[model samples]
Target: MSVTRTIPYLTIPSTSLKRGFYIGFDTDTLTTTNELGTQTIDAMAHQHHTSFLFNANELYVNEDPENGGRPPRVNENGRWVPPVYRDGFLPQAPGRMFRWNNGRIEYAGSNYQWFGGQGLTYPNNETLQHYSSTTLFWCNEFTQFQMMEADATTIDIATSDFPYNRWYPLTFRYERTLSRVSASVEEQYLAGRDGAWIAQLGLQAYRHRRNRPTEGLAGNLATIVALVAFSCTDDDTLYNVLINNLAWRGQLRVYDAEHGRRPERGVVSNIYLDPENPNGSTYDALRHLEWTDGPIIY
Candidate 1:
């Protein structure tokens, strides 16, 4: 008879965020032993912090030479450089801006100068109002399954028994303000490299109203929030062992007083592993949250 045993491998942190927020993931190593001997593997965890002014509103000026040309350019070190003009202005809206700083992706914004007294230059307020935010937490861990010989002479391990394509549970929290509102969360699964949705997960919807914590002379002073949690493991057939091109896409919709039912934002995260070799994997884990899409009510 063959015997099987299970072991706890990793744990992902629970995260919470206000309108403007930040989150990160880091890796660690662990070693475990069984009848087949001991092995080491990499584990990952998440952390969250308040991003005061990191991802503030972005700014873009009309770069068309036909539209009075472009502004003077300067590098990060304040060095002057030749101005590069674009055919048209980039979209000026609530969206995530990615920049290559050092070796990692850094969130940054464009700068615009404001002049005050005595020809002095001052920084203009370019911060945009956050409409809604989504927070997601998940984990990607490595596990090994092997078979051993009773006499410690010959052993065999089949890769087919390995859970190469494990589905990590997804927990999403959404928040928006202005008035009492209703929200819904949808999950999408992308099948192959072509990036087509093979199936759509069921959606869960709820309504929330702001509640005040302290007694005030005014009205309520609380923030409305909603939480949605589900596990992809419920559908075992959706788990693919050979190809690891599986992706999870989330869309949050909220009822707006002016816009009715509209999509606040959509997020895409997935895991990729070489089908033939599971050791080579690219885990596109969730890094941060942004309220970059939605109607601006300023």
Candidate 2:
């Protein structure tokens, strides 16, 4: 018989939480060693921050005549030097964002995040089973399945089982299913490539500068520190993964329905997630919580 193992990825908010997890603080007083500190930050964040100020979602801009109609910002082929970072943020707070509470996918991000504005009645006796990982109930099935597709099902599947594709067996995993952060994110961060642990593109950021806890309008600003490692890799790489995932879960993005999207149900069982669903229907491992949504159109 094969032994199945399970590991918990969600760390409860507390004073003793490790660097692996980040909890948001609305207060001004903050203390941490990993607060973007003196170490360099990825240039992607700077580009994104600047674009956000200009109300532009893309980095593409008109060629500057100073450089013969091709500025350094524009690449050799006249393409935006760095791509976009399109993933949304899920504030790591209680009842504020998507979470795994008491072993179930709780949608408190908002009514829109779950069902959307009023007038749509809730599904009668709805419960969904297709969470990404049975061991880690918080994960969404669509993103997990997308990751599986990207990795060719070799990374998310268990090490004990044989994968048909050429791949590296993961040392950190939860049961047969994979943890998005530990399994894939960690592997990518530590890949020993140009951008893994060190800044490859030469975009260095300082915690003291970006956060400016003492400089911003509201003194003591507790900024939302990025918690996921996959994002720290490279904006282009992150956007690439996000773009691919969109084919499967595009409308589910919040920005299309709302603005500023991290994605709520993208390509989820968006139409519905009931026992009758052919793909993301209910299973024995799932709790009683069904989602009936309208087609999110731009």
Give candidate 2 misplaced runs (Cα > 4 Å): 1-125, 129-180, 183-274, 278-298
Q: What is the number of backbone collisions in each predicted candidate, taken in the order shown?
A: 1, 7
lDDT of 1 at 76: 66
> lDDT tens digits, residues 88-201, model 1?
223322322222121122223333121110111115453332222322111111111110101011111112232221112222233332111111212111111111111111
Clashes of 1: 1
**Global lDDT scores for all candidate models:** 0.21, 0.21
Off by over 4 Å in 1: 1-27, 41-57, 63-85, 90-283, 287-298
**For candidate 2, lDDT tens digit of each residue in 1-298?**
1111112353345445554444443222223334355332233322211000000011122244553333323235543221111112111111112222222222322322222211122244233322332011111212211111111211323233443222221211111121112223222221121211112111122112222111101000000101111122323332332343331131222211111212221111111123222322333212221111211110
lDDT of 1 at 108: 33
Q: What TM-score against the true fold does each predicted structure earn? A: 0.18, 0.17
What global local distance difference test value does model 1 have?
A: 0.21
Model 1 residue 130 distance off true place after TM-score fit, in angstroms: 22
Q: What are the clashing pairs of model 2?
A: 28-220, 41-204, 41-205, 88-262, 126-290, 249-267, 252-266
lDDT at 262, model 2: 29
